[model samples]
Target: MVNRVPNEWLLYCRAGFEPDLTAEITARAHELDEPGQVVAAESNSGFVRWQSRDSRPANGIHRGLPLMSLVFARQSLVAFEPLSLSRDDRISPVVELIKESGWNFESIWHETPDTNEGKSLSRLAKSLSRPLESALKRGGGLRRKAGGRRLHLFWLAGDAVQIGMSFPGNRSEHPGGVLRLRHPADAPSRSTLKLEEAWHTFVPKEAWESRLHEGMQAVDLGAAPGGWTYQLVRRGMFVYAIDNGPMAPGLMATGQVEHLREDGFVWEPPYRLDWLVCDIVDKPMRVIDMVERWLIKRWCREAIFNLKLPMKKRWEEVQRCLTRLEVTLKAEGIEADIACRHLYHDREEVTVHVRLKGER
Candidate 1:
């Protein structure tokens, strides 16, 4: 049987974004005083591995790598695997690894890659999840309650699988870091999904009933075709769609949208607002400045915006922008919760989710 000792960290990302993730992980390890290097990561592979050359790195400093601060990776874990498919008892090794973890797993999650080839393993995952659960239960490894740790089975290939574990609140709620959202038929364009994903990522689910309700005030900068505006209107918000181009007629018919035929950069909202969203194709820092003004000047209570990134040194650029955002906010004595992520729908950009820090 072919099996390798598992000693590397596994990170799953969008297929084409492995490099961004690899760069962030390498950078973060160095920053955290963890001396390690990315052992292997190829474009479109959906995963990256960081191998630490020195065991018990950095004199055993208990530092948790800043996984949440990352802009490219989707899901991350420390794992080891690649069990032989030829073994008659392939499931035995997988179960054995889980037992050895010494965790009281509350649930089991089986995930496949994000590529078309990855989808081929879905049926296999479905078939295995229940059996694995049963075995774990029989072995007293599965917890009866729902709040304990969870186990992750990542299927990287037909013959290769990686085993890992994650805490419930600390890790992503979606399996494999992919959020499954249905495209609303009436939405102007797919771009609407980006804002929706941002809300879901940054806002807690239980608070949705109160926070995303009717009569909210919002503005969509560069909202030409009105995808972002469509989301606010759907939630019964009166929106100012700022752009120089025409908007979707369906959105206008709602009578809640004010189509501002002017530049979002120069335009300002007439009154204080509940939300601000920007999707302009401007320089990243410029976009940051635009969003920061809305927050610092108290023009809007919260915002979600995108920063168009450069071709090279993308991770460094992201770090710089985040730092500037934090420093600017601190200098002004503004309390705000800021979160950024490279969403599944984003391309060459990352999305920011910000709200007044007073509210949860």
Candidate 2:
């Protein structure tokens, strides 16, 4: 008989979003036939720990949960039980565990939750990182190679650490799954980072030249102050900025943007556009409806938009909107790729990217 044991998984999310991530993971686990219970889900903790119902091996949970399919989770990994260490020698046990596991890692990430308490542990994590790496190297457990698994040392306290591993392509590239970006000096608003991060998250870097190249015609709905429009302009795309509100003088001076004082909801493009971006603050369903209409009409080949979610049942609302959009597109025989994420720069909204297949 196969030996079965409970499995634990760690998921990181934005503080105050722990409930949503827990609900989502529970629902997903049920669907995958791997029912589990939350072992640790403190409100505003910025992290959650879940364990299976003692029915499968440790690897079962990892096989079932794909990090990309989860909207709220910033990062997910197979985590071991927390370890209590002496203040003097925090490195030896961790090195011993990796050596015993017989796993090689491409790199090691010393992480902490995205919270005030977590921030306080940063120095502790940093101080131990080099010694830990050196110890792991001495133990022959650390090897830097492309496509290798990444070992994570998540610090919960001065004496508590959780050891975990995340697959290369299946996990966020950044530590704690937060992509820290520097704001450009000339950008009109910090909101510009949302669109910029969306591109980095959804679109492959190699395809940027072809997909976001020069001379492309684009449209920015709700383009006031031109945060989103600035990204397109910087990429050398000619933009039709649609809004009744005044735009930034610097963006207009670039001669790459044509300001159209019109309502984004009702305006129609004169011809097909290469890209369509919307950052309108409205009901999530209403925004989704407009985006659906644009795609069905073939008004744009690709789109990046935001869905401002409701306070209650945010994840459920997102599911309903995405499911309906996908089903409607399928009924109309439109092939497209859709991805959504609760971006680092986003507060009460999620960024979505959709690209129609076979459309240049």
The candidate that achieves the highest lDDT relative to the unseen native structure:
2
TM-scores, all models, native as reference: 0.90, 0.95
Give lDDT tens digits, candidate 2, residues 28-127.
Answer: 8888888678889899999988876654444676767778778898998987767788888898878877776667687889999999999999999988
User: What pairs collide in candidate 1?
Assistant: 6-80
* Candidate 2: C-alpha RMSD after superposition: 2.5
Best by TM-score: 2
Q: Model 2: residues >4 Å from true position, as ranges? A: 1-6, 55-58, 144-147
Least accurate stretch of 10 residues (summed lDDT) in model 1? Answer: 54-63
lDDT of each: 0.79, 0.87
Estimate candidate 1's alpha-carbon lDDT, on a 0 to 1 scale.
0.79
